[model samples]
Target: MNLPQSPNNAPDADDDLEPVGPRPRPKGIYALPNAITLSALFASFYAIVMAMNGRFETACIAIFAAAVLDSLDGRVARMTNTQSAFGEQMDSLADMVSFGAAPALIVYQWALKDMGKLGWIPAFVYIAGAALRLARFNVNIGVVDKRYFQGLPSPAAAALVMGLIWVVDDAGIKGVGRVDWAAWSAFAVTLFAGLSMVTNAPFYSFKVFGGRRSVPFIVLVAIALGIAVVSLDPPRVLFALFCAYGLSGYVIYGIKKSRGKPVSVIATSTDEPDEEGLHR
Candidate 1:
């Protein structure tokens, strides 16, 4: 019996036909990073709702917790090699809500409300600055120096706002009582911090994950002890410390420029050679 001609040896009736158009991607979602991002978004939304209810202290804590969660999601993504364009964009959006809008609104409701229109203006300024900061950061990632940030980081900026409120609340607990002028001053402070987020001044970014260190173990222990002492009164200590750090960039930048040794601008090109001729 003659077997039918093999299909591979025979020309199909539609042999001249082009293959179908590229298939659409299957609809599925990544789990871990997306989950973390959603949690952060929830935290931001909770912060706004709590602030509206006049739960000012709880709102501040929620924002800080959200900030912590935001930091983790990226590192987790990188470690898991699950990075994606969708996740990156979602992260930035969550940050704007958590670190930008939430903190500003909380501060405004907690303290700056007394200043009326002027108070609201600073909150708006801060939110605008955070948006700009995040946009710039997303664009500059991997292009700029990883060791230092080009300007004040959005989380740090939010921290400054939260720290100030915490300090004020603590003082209120101590019977210092709220002052109208203090609220106005806080508005001014927040506005200045927001402006600084987009400035060119370099701030130490604490990117010490893989660097050599000469400090001895004892020195690190001492530093940890100092930090622990300060943390005992977190509201007072952290507020003052972050406020100083927030202002330090401008002060240090001005001093260096005046001395004719300008702070190094963030390196934008990655192909330049180092002293030993390896690519920077």
Candidate 2:
């Protein structure tokens, strides 16, 4: 009803219209990537359960499985263009379980538990390092160099701790809690891994290898040989490889420092240009 038309024939304002509220958040998550993350979380849970049962070898294997799944989920999310904030948060939380708490608990249960009060030190330090590392990574994701990680990644640190257990357990070492040398070695490795994670040393992330870039034919051959070697003696070889990697950050840091190169991987905050796919 055009009862009170203005000069431009505008309609009279109504007083009965309901005010619009803020939009509701969407409920569901992307299935494929999040499912992989959930699987990783389940693997961590299984590892903890296995550790409780004194099945440490199985527990170590479960953590490794979780690491593999953890690595895949992000790639899968990017590949399928399903990278969501939800998936990112889920991945970080799953990582905390798999790499943070699970390794600490497993290592403690295996060897550290025998050390009385001293045992909890390294275990607690390891978990704390994981928490700090994860938090730093999340905050620095966009600013840090893609070629390098700020420090030893939590998954790799987890591997360092779990690999010690796996190698000893595979060697048929029984009653780890009673073995002084083994427990001491576990303590040292766990401590080293924990400290390595919180350092400013830049670790090579290997992100460039799988991307759409051309590498030498020797790279493929090297990967194949590496796999074959790992398959021969999974426990010993994996532990050895991870051990080398555990020390690599400091080596790189030393080299960079000696050369007077910038050690931190973080980009300068001049223009703050957002790179595509960097935030997730």
Error of 1 at 133 (Å): 1.0
**Using alpha carbons, what is the TM-score of model 2?**
0.87
Candidate 1 contains a number of clashing pairs equal to 0
Lowest summed lDDT window (length 10), candidate 2: 271-280
- Tens digit of per-residue lDDT, candidate 2, span 84-137: 898999999999999999999999999999899999999999999999999989
Estimate, for each residue in 159-244, the C-alpha lDDT of model 1 and write its tens digit: 89888777776665422115766676678778987998988787877666423547667878888897898869977787787888
Among these predictions, the greatest lDDT belongs to: 2
Candidate 1 lDDT at 208 equals 69
After superposition, the stretches of candidate 1 with alpha carbons farther than 4 Å from their true spots are 1-29, 173-178, 210-223, 262-264, 269-280
In angstroms, the error of model 2 at 146 is 0.8
lDDT of 1: 0.78
Off by over 4 Å in 2: 1-28, 270-280
What would the TM-scores of all predictions be? Answer: 0.78, 0.87
